[model samples]
Target: MKPFPVATALTIAGSDSGGGAGIQADLRTFSFHRVHGTSAVTAITAQNTRGVTRVDLLPPESVTAQVDAVASDMRVDAVKVGMLAQRPLIEAVADQLARVSLGPIVVDPVMVSRAGSQLIDNEAVEALRSRMLPLAAILTPNRHEAKLLAGMDIQTLEDMREAARRIHALGSRVVLVKGGGMPGALRGTDVWFDGTRMETLSVAPVDTPNTHGTGCTLSAAIAARLALGAPPLEAVRLAKEYVTSALRYPLAVGHGNGPIGHFFPLIHD
Candidate 1:
């Protein structure tokens, strides 16, 4: 008998040729969750596990066309958006997603790379907040991005809570302030703040240097769980577990940073 059609997830993001982050990581995370994955490339990055050397933003029309094509044919249950390079592109993606009525959107506010290179421009950050956050089901911003969005320094757990509240007020129904960037912490803590309540999800940081794709993997896994009919909190829980495992079995590639083992279980398979 033919297998049943898996729930589909669409990733609107950049292409990371390194196979560690961006569209590559998104697709791998979806596959690991047993979901069908589709993509609309918004930008192309000359990047590896080491760093992003260059970025080329795809034309806004081309980006819109890809999203339209995928939405027209596929039953996209969830979307993970990342690495929109410019203001016009951000606005275009927001517009296209609105037109298609894409549900269960997980916005990973990817601003900088693991190697400390700025990914999104200054103006695009504002555009992202105004154009995209309102439509997102959940906004996943790392501590630094959270600070940028909340317009203040988040130096403590209390600050994280306040930042989450402020970011939620910006229009996202849920805000996940990722705490991996916080100082004096080996255990990564993610604070999930829905309108009604706040929950802290903590995991001991995997002792590995190969963490090139953690954010993209986490956000995409959440999208996959959402596609599989999991609630927001539950989705985040599962995604965190997956990311921790991935980090534990990171691929020992590249001279600088290295990619996480997305198919870490494939050795058994």
Candidate 2:
């Protein structure tokens, strides 16, 4: 018999040797959603659970070549972009992605830290906001990132809504301002805005210290659902649900923060 049909998704991100985040987490999340995963790694990080020791970025040409190799051979049903840490890499990936035909592109804006620190340079931030966000089907930015992008402080739920609106104006088809870093009872409440429809996506916060890869995992799950032909809103909803459940089954590995249970269904604990 012929091989079974399968949906394929591509992750254009960095590698986490720790296996908690970056390309490793993305592929795991894809597999959990039953989507075949492909990758074009932008950086290699020498790190484990505790922290990153070093990072080496792949040449922009090499990154684009990997993308070309995949696109020429197979149909990429969806694309998840994460952690393009500089201007050149950000522009290159955006150019390469535009040249290829892919499904919903989930842009995980990883430019700001939870502590309100700017993780990327101003030029890189501008490049991502200009090149990547415009191509994004869904742009996922956490509290601090939304603060940077929208040029406003996010201290309340309404602030999140405003941030989402501002980001949506920047051309992303949809903007999801993640509230995981928000204060008080609003922590797990996510604000979604798509120019027209706006709503808050909320779930009871999962109480787990092993929340490593949460951002990457959630975006990857969204891309996985997109690969499987789910509508944008439905994909985000499903991904959120998946992340919440996986957090409940957190893995107790690593010396520091560990990964959430990607294959939660298989764990018999």
Candidate 3:
């Protein structure tokens, strides 16, 4: 028999001690999609289901070291970036990504927490917009993040479309503005734009308090699908489907928002 082909993905992000978001969630999502997962942790958060108590960023050199090590050895097929929580970290990540020829980069601009709190400073936001956005193959930002990136409030579907356009103009090949944070009927509806075309993607909203890692999971799934050789748009669609299915069964592990069920298929075995 011929040797099996390998699909590898890299996640450059923070470490979530809660095991619900950041690097933990990204790796889990990659594994579920059958992609080899590697990560470069940029920060470490002392957090749990309830909330984040503290956060410590790694030195810029350390972050770059991890990325260099992975890219030097592995044929990484895709990349997912999350939680570059500081300006220095963002700049470091942007610089290293520029040097390495990793495949499609999926950037999840994680600027705000699920509870509506700003996580990154204004300088960091600007750094990401100017330095990292241009390198992204797909930029996935939730309603709040889109608001910050696009410099406009996103209250309606039309607004999301506008936001996607503005963000895409920043140089990302495509933009996916998640409407999960929107109130009522608009929830779960994601606006997708590829500079020329715009569309909406949605699945039945799964009702659960466990949405801690939803953003990380979705972006990582997109990277995973891309690593598996799907085109950008198809990768986004498959990633959405995967997240929706995973959300169907929430793992009741913590008191606050828990993680999405990233390994449902394996759990049965």
Q: Which candidate is the best by TM-score?
A: 2
lDDT of 2 by residue, 151-228 (tens): 999999999999999999999999999999988899899999989999889999988888889999999999999999
- Ordered from best to worst TM-score, the candidate numbers read 2, 3, 1
RMSD of each: 1.6, 0.9, 1.5
Candidate 3 residues 1-269, lDDT tens each?
Answer: 99777799999999999899999999999988889999999899999999889999899999899989999998999999998988888988898889889999999998986557898889999999999999999999999999988999888999999999999999999999998898788899999999988989987788888887899999999999999999888999999998998887778897887888898876644
Q: Which stretches of candidate 3 lie over 4 Å from their true place?
A: 1-4
Sorted on lDDT, best first, the list reads 2, 3, 1
**Between candidates 1 and 2, which one is better according to TM-score?**
2
| Candidate 1 deviant stretches above 4 angstroms | 1-3, 114-117
Candidate 1 per-residue lDDT, tens place, 195-268, comes to 87998889998878888889999999999999999999999999999899888888878887798888989853
Question: TM-scores of the models, in the given order?
Answer: 0.95, 0.98, 0.96
